[model samples]
Target chain A: MNLHEYQAKELFARYGLPVLPGQVAQTPEEARDIAAALGGTVVIKAQVLVGGRGKAGGVKLAHGPDEAYDRARDILALTIKGLPVRKVLVARAAEIARELYLAILLDRSRKLPLIMLSAAGGVDIEEVARTAPHRIVRRHIPLEGLRPYQARALLKPLFREGSQLTQAADILMKLWRAYSEGDCSLAEINPLAVTPEGKVLALDAKVILDDNADVRHREWEIWRDPDEETLGQRVAREKGLSYVKLDGDIGCVVNGAGLAMATMDLIKHYGGEPANFLDIGGSSNPEKVTAALRIITGESRVRAILFNIFGGITRCDDVANGIVQSLKQSPLPIPLVIRLTGTNEEQARKILSENGLSATTSMDEGVRAVIAKAQEVTA
Target chain B: MSIFIDKSTRLVVQGITGRDGAFHTGQMVAYGTKVVAGVTPGKGGEKLQGVPVFDGVAEAVAATRANASVIYVPAVFAADAIFEAADAGVGLIVCITEGLPVRDTLAAYHHVAALRSRNGTGRPRLVGPNCPGLISPGLSKVGILPGHICKPGPVGVVSRSGTLTYEVVQQLTHAGLGQSTCLGIGGDPVIGTNFIDALEAFAADPRTEGIVLIGEIGGSDEEEAAQFIKRHVRKPVVAFIAGQTAPPGKRMGHAGAIISGGTGTAAEKMAAFEAVGVPVANIPSEIPSLMAEAMGRRRPRSNRAAAGKARRARAASRPRPAARDRARPAAKRARARARKPARRAVARAAGGRGRR
Candidate 1:
């Protein structure tokens, strides 16, 4: 899950990280209250789960309470990248002496945590890498160990001279601890701004915790946002299936994540878009199928439903029964294509036919049938 | 001659008393896998499906001499199960459970790597903590991989897609090919046993003739595998990459499938495979046939071209029941109120939202 800047900062503050005092406000009056509490110039930023908010007029500097309210009013009502502003983060603006970038993320290739650092900060890191790849510095922390000194070494170039080097290294080491102990998949302190007074503050923060690690990281649970996706995905999650909403017409219900991806690819290859990625996983219970189909049909963009269950340990008969049960409950008006394989496939097909639902056994035939039905309906 | 599991590999079931554990164990045992023991805390000495259940992995390993382990534990405890099996010196670990915490996986992966490096031996090969697992027909099935569809043959398989593995096997079977072994490496962002890992094993296996590698858009797993193929693998590999036209910047299905900037795309994977001398098949249906042709099968020329043609023609020939199915009621309602102009009820069935 992705936590907004305010949410991440709040968690960082709770963990004793140096963070600027900030409050979230939904209206101008609330912004004024937040500014008055800070009693200084505050930065008003639009709360959206996207980047480049500043470039889009979603972030502004407010001189005082009056300016804070004006900026919040403008930003709170504006939309950035099609996501409406529901909240604005009002933070006390920091005096900058120097800026640096630091982040820790999983390197999939190495199967270990990687720490990324750079002297350049407060801009898109991708741009920096593209334009001047030499500036960005990265270090891999082996699974067997994490050395604080090694992490500090990655930021050695940023130290340059004077007392700033020790302070920067100290901050980097502390950030590494926060990255590891916090169970953060991504912990970034962009523009680790140095004030004229020479104190470091995490002027901006972005932290994404591993959702699966939520059990281990007890304090991070307050950052969970259940309202990110469509209701179907939330329902599917509750039912223990992996479902991600997509923008398309065909409702794809497949068995495995990889297969689900391939099925979606096939849908697109056939010029038919997939509406969602719903994987019932290895279980083929009728209830799970019922839940998956109900979630699919409940979707407004789904014109046709495709059931691609390559039953292995999951009996095909069980998948067929689930589809039958789901159809009985919802009475699918949209065209349905069922492709059942693996253990007891004949029995599965027999059950479907017996229930007056003849599903195609061929994947090509099943995908073709669903795509055609989708086009016919939309046409 | 199979890559990983064969008749000689003794298997142990972890979390044996659980519902999925029991169900899949029954299916695997019926499918001829030599399931010697089960491991569940406090369930030691109990018999499940005529197999002895042990209290721990060490006990199960010591008693049964089980070299292979299939874990069915929940996501919360999956990492511990893998670590337990890894610690117990199990030669092969197949984890069928999904939803392992990323942090746990990171720790487990590092531990496994360390053990592999520290022991002066390779890591006990892990298939998945979130995958469907692997099946070696007429050998030992060490996972919850659906074995009913697989039969013994000479074809080697490695895939990031679980369901696509079946699709490839079905086509291969229809084409008179049986797989020596099939591995579903899974599509989770973090997984055990990547394509390169399986490719190395399949390349060395004597029974395996050629390999069918199916990959999807996301991550550099496919690219790494392709590089390995170019560097070491001599086996003729047939590759099918998924999500060619997936919308830019939007995640198709896998969290790793998001196209950020320019790298890690299906097209890039295809190019990598092609550059590595691995024949890339764009259409899914063409996979088995391409492998068959690579194996020196006499296929009709028209059929091969038509398969590609059919994929294109299929774009426009998709079946639609909505118009005819829903129109029946609409036509009757229109006749009932012929005096008034018919106001079309906005089709809220599917593809209703996001219409321009």
Candidate 2:
């Protein structure tokens, strides 16, 4: 549900936030057209979801349309962090007098929306926190929304009570509107730049929409990146499976999201890297299980497939049936490990045993069995 | 003696005409829950499984005098349902629905909190937006928990997972242990109840001799719970954190479950639990043993009648398809038939998005 910088800025502008005027283009010619219309030094940024774009040479500056076109062409050809640059955003670059950080996000521990501010900007906030902790300031916004006086208080430390403070506070308030009004899970402006002309602009915007809120905001789907998924992910989405492919060798299929992660963690603890995070979810139908198995086996790196199901409402017998049918279709391409427990487990075990397969109720035993099978050939 | 629900509890089911609402309602009633009322907007005059249905929560509350409300509505309307329940003066609310919009939850949460502050008594307790609800063995079952697997016992449980909570509960019951109450606070990023709230309630309950806390790698909730355990809880607590080896920056199913910038890792949570004198189980199965040891050190069992009632009730409620004499495919097909309407309701309510 993360939006590219261009998309984020589009929402920002809708909320009257001080973001520089920008346009998204698919080609270098389009980039040139945008830059020529703006008639100023422009920043051409590659539109990809991955972070560290500047470090990856995905961002460049150009003084004119020709240079803008050249920069966009170069960025478009580059693949940063395995994601191709399909789109580029061209905007009038600003001369900055000061740069600061501002963000509004859900503080999980507090169960509240929190706004964090910092005097330092254009650098990773985590790095700033690690190096100069006092430079950053944090505030929790109550349900009543951020007040004008409170916004003033947030800016007071970064500035002496003046126009700079008022203007920045206004921008922070606007950022809150884009966050709350837009129903974003996370909204940030990394470099809230103060221009040489004393105008504050959101230099870089990032908005992570709350996926659950999509029903409320029907128009948000246009921001989806078409190429951001793997084949397994695409199929899983259509099949109603929760799957995230990872750079590992052990494939995992589990019921319930929490148990899936724990299964992966346990595998890692026993010296195995999980190939993906797959949660068929509760009361999974047989079709989903078949799809999960097919998706995992499709990946050649997978040396073992693990099924860790702790069924409550999800009947273990249903899962066992899925496993049995999958094995019948073709011999398991890799070793199989299962730890099935809870509701209908006795029936599930009977099915597995009749098929010359059995499951361990113990998670530790299941983890060891899979890791051993995985290591048999690799060693 | 349970932390939340008990024999005196009068329950109402929201979304009672919907698929999940109707199915779990039958299970709850069969498990001996006093589900006196149901609410489904336009279908209020109808009777669902002998329970009276109302168009609004206020009418349902007034008619049936149901103090506890369990929600099985679609995620889109879940927040409003909660607000409706709270507005109608339901003392406790358990939302089994998942994928509620976080901002809507924020507003709903604050509304409930504000009401609690204004009243200062019988404040609403929300269980989950994506959870299995909860169970008080032999006394009341207000959620989708397999009641047959639970027995009333000395330990009270709270977790942030659905089946994992049931798994630990199952292991606890399998080894001749029973539970007083178990709470699934859910896996959503913003939820009403956390480990701290449940811990405080368990600490005050007389029947709970020991407690089990199952946490996953997520927000700083575990750490906050650790601090609460250290300060408020004198009862011996056994804890386990899931996702120990989860990689940084990847969300492991739960929206609240991402490890951002090396914070909220299982290692940090385990360290906090250990620092607070709570033993963290190495594996899920080891929890019952740890709880046995922890309970054995401090107190002897006193709630014997409840335990016996739990055992008898569980024996009575186990799903009959596991008898093994029946045809397996027939049983599965029958179960699927029973689940279709509810599943379809859930799918339609889910609107084909968000984490299930």
Candidate 3:
């Protein structure tokens, strides 16, 4: 659900924030055209989902149209942190006299939105937090609302001159408004520079919209990349199960995420690796379990499968039926360890036992058996 | 003796009209939980499994005086269902629905917090908006979670982890200790009640003698709870932190299971618990003994021996590459150094053999 830099900046512009003029270029020709239209120094940046693009040589500068085209072509050709750049952003470069950092993010401990600002800019905030946390001034926005005076007070120390402080305060207030109204989890202006012309422009803009609020924001949906999804994740999404693929070899199908993770961890603890994360959720229907198993078995790395269901609303017998059906539907070659508990557990055990699959009530034994079985195959 | 539900706890099932809801509700009521009423909006004055079904939580509360609620509502309407239960003044709200939008949960959490602040009566306590709910083994069970794995005893259980709670309780049951109260606090990022809140309640319960806190990676909630336990908790507590060597930078089962940038990790949580004199266990099998030792029923055992054995077992259990990860890298280095001259000699001998 992460937006590209151009999309974030687009939202920023809509919020009335001062962002450098930019154009999203899907091709080198479009980038050259954009650079020519801007008629000034341009910054070409790779449009990747991950951060550290600049550090990974995904960003470059050009003085003229040809140079801009060359830079964009280079960035589009490059891979930043393993993600290839299919597009590049051509932005007019701003004159920087002094750089500053500004961001507003949710502070979980305080249960409020916290504004972080620093005179130092254009560096990873984590490193800044680790090295000199005191340099960063934080102000928690009260539920009552953010006041312009408070914004002015925060900016007052950063600028000795009154005019620069006033201008910075106005921009900060606008940023806070965007953060609150735009449903952003995070909005940052790195290298929020004061130009030689005595005006402030956001040299770099980053915005992370809350995924939960995305339903209400249709404009934000356009920024979503459909190709970003993993095959298992796509299948899980379609099947209505919360599935996140992991790197381990032991495929886990459980009733809950907490339990699913615990099952995966248990496998790891017992000397097995989890192939994927699959949660059948509260409604442990036969279809959901079947889909989950299909997704797990799709993973070639998975040598064994672990079925852990704590069936509260999900009956153990129903889950057992699902497992039996999955086994019947596909002649799965991997070893299976089933731990069924809660309501109808006896019935479930009966079903499994009838199918010649001995279910274990003991999780330790189940984990041990699964790990042992996986080990047998890998060996 | 249980912190929440017990034998006499009145229970009502929400979304009882749904197929899954009716099935689990029937199962739960059959399992001996006092089935007072059921709630499905616009379906009041009906009955499911011989239990009265009310149109809404308020009507259900008014008719049956049902103090406890188990929600099986869809994720879309889960927030409204929770608020309905809260508004109806239910003593305990256990939501079994997962995949609630983060905003919906935030609103629900905020509403509950606001309710708590406004009431001044400490009226209803929220368990989960996404959790599997609570179960009082041998007494009352509300959740759809498999109930047979647990047995009523003195070991108070509190966990952010749901699937493993059954395993923990199973181990405890096998070790001959029944659970006083077992709670799955939900694995959602912004949950209603946390480990410390449940632990504090467990600490106050006279029937409870010990606690087993099942912790996972992500967020500082566990570390904070561990600190609180050190400062305030009186009951003997055993800790088993899951995902010790979980691969970093990957979101596993829950949104909260990812360990990135060194913040809520198993190792860190274990260290925090250990600093507070709480016995930390590495494996699920080790939890029962740790709990026994904490309760003064067994002697403290060496974790080193268990670790060594687990390492060797794990190495033997995994693929060759993974087995190498568990191998002594220092030993590998030393062997590589010793083989340097041998490799040179072999190369020279290979040259001679080729010449011949």
Candidate 4:
């Protein structure tokens, strides 16, 4: 649910924050038109979902329309951190006499939205945190919005007492409004630059929306980035499966989120590494099992697959049938280990046995058997 | 010895007649829970699993006097269901629905907490928004935990994961150890009843001689529980945490099961448990023996039916990965304690019960 920089800036501008006017251009011709209209030096930023765009040579400055088109062409052809640049943002370049950092984020440890401001900007905050810890100022905003005085206090040391300070504080408040109203998990402006003309503007925008809060925020759908989602994730989402791929050799398919976690933990404990975290949820649809195996076996890193089902409301027979059906379509190269118990366990075992496969009832035994089989395959 | 419920405990089922509601309701009734009433708007007169249905929480409460409510409502209306149950004077509410929006949960938590403060008595204690509820095994059951896997015993179990809780409880039952009460506090980002709340109840319950805490990579609830054990708990405690190899920034299946800002890792949580004098188990199967060690006794030999499987599980046990406790080797010390088997549970029960 991460919003691209242009989209985040749009929300920022909508909330009355000072963000430079920008246009998204998918082609070099559009970039030329946007650059010509801005009339001054424009910044061409690659619109990819990854950070470190400057480090990756995706962001460049252009003085005129021709230069803007050339820069956009170069960026659009480049892939930064495994994501191809699809579009470029042409924005009016701002004159910066000083750069400051600001962000409002939900700190899980504090259970509060933290307002952070730093005198140092235009660099990784992790680096700043490591080098000089005292340069940053942070305050927790409890359910209530960040107050004016609190915002001023965090920004006071970064700027002198003047219109710049007042303007920065105002923008911070507006940013808070955008953050809460938009149900954002993170709202950040890396460089709140102070121009020579004494105007403070948000130079870069980063906003991460909370996916769980989408029940209320229907207007944010246009901000979804399909490239950010892996193919496995997209397929799982469409099939109503909750899956997050990992890097290991043992693949897991379990019912219930908690069970999926424990299955992974048990795999690690038994001297095996889990390749992914996949939860089919409470439904015992055979089709979900089929799709889950397809997703897991599709991974090149997976050496063996494990299915741990403690059927409560989920019927074991459906899962067994799904396993048999999937194997019939195309037999998986990796070995499969399944542990089925509870609610029609006998029927599930009979189905698996009839399909020339067997299931274990003990979780420890199942994990051990899978690890051994996976090891044999690797050897 | 059970902490939450027993035979006489009355229950109300919210979202009754729905898919999950009807299915789990049948399980609860079969498990001997006193399911007195159900609530589902427009399905008031319908009978579900022979339980009387009402339109709202207030009507259901007035007619049946259900002191506890377990909600199976979807995430959209789940928060209101909590408010409705609390407003109707139910003392205990268990929410089993997952995927509840965090904003809605925050509002529900505050509303329930505020009502308790204003009334000054009979405050409702909420279990979870994404949890498997609690079971006082062999007496009464609420929520979705399978009843047959557990047996009544002196061990009290509290966990954040439903399946891991079942895995550990089943292992304990297989090893001839029974739980006085087992509860899954849930894995959501913001849950109502934390590990501390469950630990506090277990500490006060006379039936619980030892406790097992199963935590995953998540919030600082496990660390707080370790601290609470140091200050107040007298019962022998054993702990296990999942997601040891979980990569940073990955969601790891649960909403709250992510390592954020270099904290909430399983290694840190295991260290916290060690610092507070509680034994830690590396895997779920080790939980029963660790709890036995904490209780200063040997695990009673399992029945003949499970003997072969138990032997195979023992044979499959392997050395765990690199110990995260670089200097202390705190978990190894816990294994050492298992060999000595000091009778702390007997001494504590005889030591005038250590003043609350």
Candidate 5:
């Protein structure tokens, strides 16, 4: 749900905010073409979702088209934070008189959108929060959203000139529109720069859309970065399961988000590392379990697969049936341990036993068994 | 006995006639919940599972005097459904719908808050936009929680996750500890109820002798709850937090279960609880014993042993289908019971530390 700098800028531009003209280029030639068109000193930024791109040498400033092409080539060849640079944003660089930070994000504690403004910008906000806590000012937006007067009041400390304050407030209002209308969890402008000519421009943009609001904004589907998704994640998403890959040997499939996390924690507590976190969700549709197994088993690093199901709305029998049916289709090479309890648990145990498999009802017992089995496989 | 719903809860189902709504409504009715009405805008004047259906929440409330409403409507209409339920004067609103936009939840939450300020006496309590709802064991079931996993007793349970609540509740039940009420406050970033709200209720309720709080990596609700427990709650409280191994910035299934910007980590929450003198359980199964220790700590020195004996007796009297269903021999069960003291000793040793 994270948008690249270019994408965020594009969204910002659509709201008539003062964003530098930028173009995304996948190749050096395209980068040259964009740099030539902009006809000024340009910044070539790697289009990756992770932070610290500049520190990783993925961002470079170029004086002309030739330099822009060379910078883009270097960036495109680099892998920053394990993600290969697939695209670069070629934008006209700004001449900043001063830099400021502006953002509106959903504050979980307040259960409302919060506008955060700071005099410090172009660096990690968290670092600023830790070191100079007084620099940042935060105001919670009401259900009606960020009002124009509220935006001006929030920005007044950062801006000295009345015209500049009004201009910045207008931009803040536009950013709020983009955040609320586009259903964004976060919309940030780092280094809201005031040029020597006294015009304000957003040097960088980062926007994270709320995935839960996808129903309202189906058009946002085009913005999804397929490159960011692992094959397992993609398949899991298609199967209506939540799966996150981790570097471990014990693959865990559990019901509910909290239980999935708890299952992972228990695996680690028992001295075993979990390869993935998979939640089949509340409805115990047998197909989801089958899909979950297929995804987990697809990871060759997994030495053992553990199923921890505590059924509530989810019936344990459906999960057992899914496991049985999956094993029948293609047997697992890795060891499988299941701990089933709660609703329809007896029926689930019966189904597993009929298939020459048995499940423990105790989470501790099951976690211990799986860790032992995984260790055996390693040994 | 319960903090929220009990035998007096007259429930109404919103989006009744829909698949999930109809299905869970039938389950609630089967669990002895007094489901007085159903609300479906177009499918009114019909009976679903012998419950009368009405055109809207207002009509349903007027006709049946349904004091509580559970919504299973789709995410698009969920916010309006909350507004309707609140406007219709339902005192307790439990929304089971998931994937509601945060904006909608915020609006609904503020609307309810505004109503609370305007009309302080009968303002409604909203449980969740994405939760399994709550159950008062043997008295009433409101949402989708499986009632059989619970039993009527002195313990009160509140959690952020659904099946995780069941996991801990089943452990408590197997340990011969039943619950007064078990509630899931939902895992969305914005929810109607929070840990402090539920903890305060449990602290005030006389029937709730001990409290088990199941929290995960998310907002500082658990940390705030820990503070609330330290300042307000005198009851024995045991806490368990999930997502100890979860990496930062990844939503671990639940939309809200993410460790963002070096905050909302499980370790932080656990530390908060430990600082507040709440026993933090390392695993879900360890919660019942931790609850026992917490409760035992509050009693007089001589009564501690007597309380332990009473808890063991209660556990022994319960039909332990969980152990028996493993198909283990009787001798193995006896050996497992014999090893309980050793496990308890280990748990006690690790009690001072939030994490090993």
Candidate 6:
């Protein structure tokens, strides 16, 4: 749910935060047109989700419309971190100034929204925290949210006095509004820049909305980037499964979040790599299991498919029936191993046995079996 | 003797008329939980599975004297349900609902913290917004845990996962290490109960001779729990953490289960536990052996043997699942069939969304 720089700026503008005017263009000609309309030196940034876009040469400065087109074309042709630039954000370049970092995020430990401000900005906050921890100041916002006085106090260390501090505090308050109202897990302005004229502007914006809050904020659907999702991930999501693709040979399908991760860990521990992490979730039926199997088998790199279901509310029999039904439809070319236990496990074992597919109940045994099978396939 | 629930827990099922509510309510009642009443707005005066239904938690609490409440409402209404249960003076609120917005949870959590019960008994102890509720083996089953896999004994288990809890509990039972109580505090980033709360309760319970903590990569709760275990817990505690192989920035199914900003990783949490002298199990199956070894190390040889004998005798004396309860799968399968249309609609609406 990470918003691109341009989308984050759009949200920042909606919340009345001071942001430089920017337009996102999908093509080099569009970038040139936007630069021409702005009539100034423009910065063209690749709109990929990964970090270090500038380090990857996906960000370039252009003096005019013609140069903007050239920069955009080069960025568009290049792929950064395996994700091609689908769009470029063209904005009027800001004058030289000091950079400061400001962010509002959900503090998992405190279970509250935390606002962090630092004199050091426009760089990786983690690097700053690691190298110069004292430069960063943090405050936890209670349920009542960030107070104006608290925002002013947080900015006082960065800005001593006058309109700069006032404007910075105002932007912080507005950023809180965008964060809370937009149901964002993180809203950041990394490089809250001060111009030579002393005016402050957010040079970069990154906002990540809380996905669980999507029920209330349906309008956030427009922010979803389809290009970011692989076909397997999209299908798994549509089927109500949690799936994350990784570069491994053993495809994992498990019942719970913790068990899924443990399975992946056990696979790695047993000298095998996991292709993906997929959780069928609680109360599974045949179709969901079928969907999970289909999604896993769709991965060509997956040499062996593993089903590690420790059924509680999710009946083992249901999952067994799903495996049986799925294999009947389109038999897997890869080695298939399953470990079923818990509720109705006897019946599930019987079901699997009848289909000529034996199962193991021990997780360690299953991991060893799957790793062995996967290696055999690889060999 | 359990940490949170036992035989005296007069339970109330919120959203009793809903699909999940009805199914799990049946399971709870069959497991010998005293389900005194049910709360389903607009269904007052009706009966669900022979339990009286009320329009509100206040009325339900007043009439039936239900001290504990389990919620199965949808995500949007879960926070309000918590507020209602808290306002009505329910002593223990276990919300089984998942996908509650963090904002709503924050509001509910703070609201409950600030309010005292009507009877001046203190604020209600909220267990989860997404969890399989606690179980006291043969004593009482509060939420959706399968009771057949559990056995009452000396071990107190706490986890942030549903099926993972079941896996570890079943392994403990198979290894002749029955549990005194098992609690799933849930896998949400912001839950009412956490590892520290459960660990404190386990530390105080005399019947809980040893503790088994199941944690995953996420918040600093596991690390904090490790510190608590080092300071307050005198009993032997064994730990197992999932997501050791999970990549950073990926939400591993649970809303709280992610490694963000280079913190909350499994390696970090595991190190925190190891630094505190707590033995961390590499896999779930290794938990029982670790617990046994830790407990054996704490007690003398004769006392350990005596405790094992006592645990075995107590497990033998406990009643098994009734024959009628053994016929549960058919009913459960029927309920699963009935829930397909609704589940499909929800999946359709939430297609390709981010992790819940």
The candidate 3 chain B region of ten consecutive residues with least summed lDDT is B347-356
Per-residue lDDT, model 4, residue A243, is 86
Model 1, position B72, has a per-residue lDDT of 92
Query: By summed lDDT, which 10 consecutive residues of candidate 6 chain B come out lowest?
Result: B347-356
- Model 3: how far is B300 from its true place, Å? 16
**Per-model RMSD to reference:** 12.8, 11.3, 13.7, 9.5, 6.6, 10.8
Please give the range of 10 consecutive residues that has the lowest summed lDDT in model 2 chain A: A281-290
Q: How many pairs in model 2 have backbone atoms within 3 A of each other, for residues 3 or more apart or on separate chains, i.e. clashes?
A: 4
Q: Residues B67-186, candidate 4: write the lDDT tens digits.
A: 999999988899999999999999889999987877678778777877878888637888898899999999999999988889988899999888778778887877667889999888
What are the chain A TM-scores for all the models, listed individually?
A: 0.94, 0.92, 0.92, 0.90, 0.97, 0.97
Residue-level lDDT for A283 in candidate 1? 77
Candidate 6 CAPRI-style tier: medium
Residue B166 miss distance in model 6 (angstroms): 0.7
TM-score of each: 0.87, 0.88, 0.83, 0.87, 0.92, 0.91
> Top DockQ: which candidate number?
5
Q: Considering only chain B, report the TM-score of model 3.
A: 0.81
Residue-wise lDDT of candidate 3 within A157-207, one digit each (tens)?
Answer: 898887788888888888888888787767889878999888888878888
- Location of the lowest summed lDDT over 10 successive residues in candidate 4 chain B: B347-356
- In the range B1-356, model 3's lDDT, one tens digit per residue, is 88888877898888998976898887787778898999887888777779888888888888888998888888878889989999999878888776676657767777777888888866577777557677777788877656777777788888877767776787677666778888888776677888878988898888888899988887778888888987898778988887775666555566556665557778899999999988888777777766665565322266546766887897786677556656758788677757665333322423323111
* Leading candidate by TM-score: 5
Local distance difference test values of all predictions, in order: 0.79, 0.86, 0.78, 0.85, 0.89, 0.89
What order do candidates take by DockQ, descending?
5, 6, 2, 4, 1, 3
Q: Which pairs, if any, clash in model 2?
A: B19-B342, B97-B129, B153-B178, B153-B179
DockQ of each: 0.35, 0.46, 0.25, 0.39, 0.68, 0.57
Docking class of 2: acceptable
Once superposed on the true structure, which residue ranges of model 1 sit more than 4 Å away at CA?
A284-287, B245-263, B297-356
Which tens-of-lDDT digit does each residue in B74-132 have in candidate 2? 99899999999999999899999988888888888888988988988848877777888
Interface RMSD of candidate number 6: 0.9
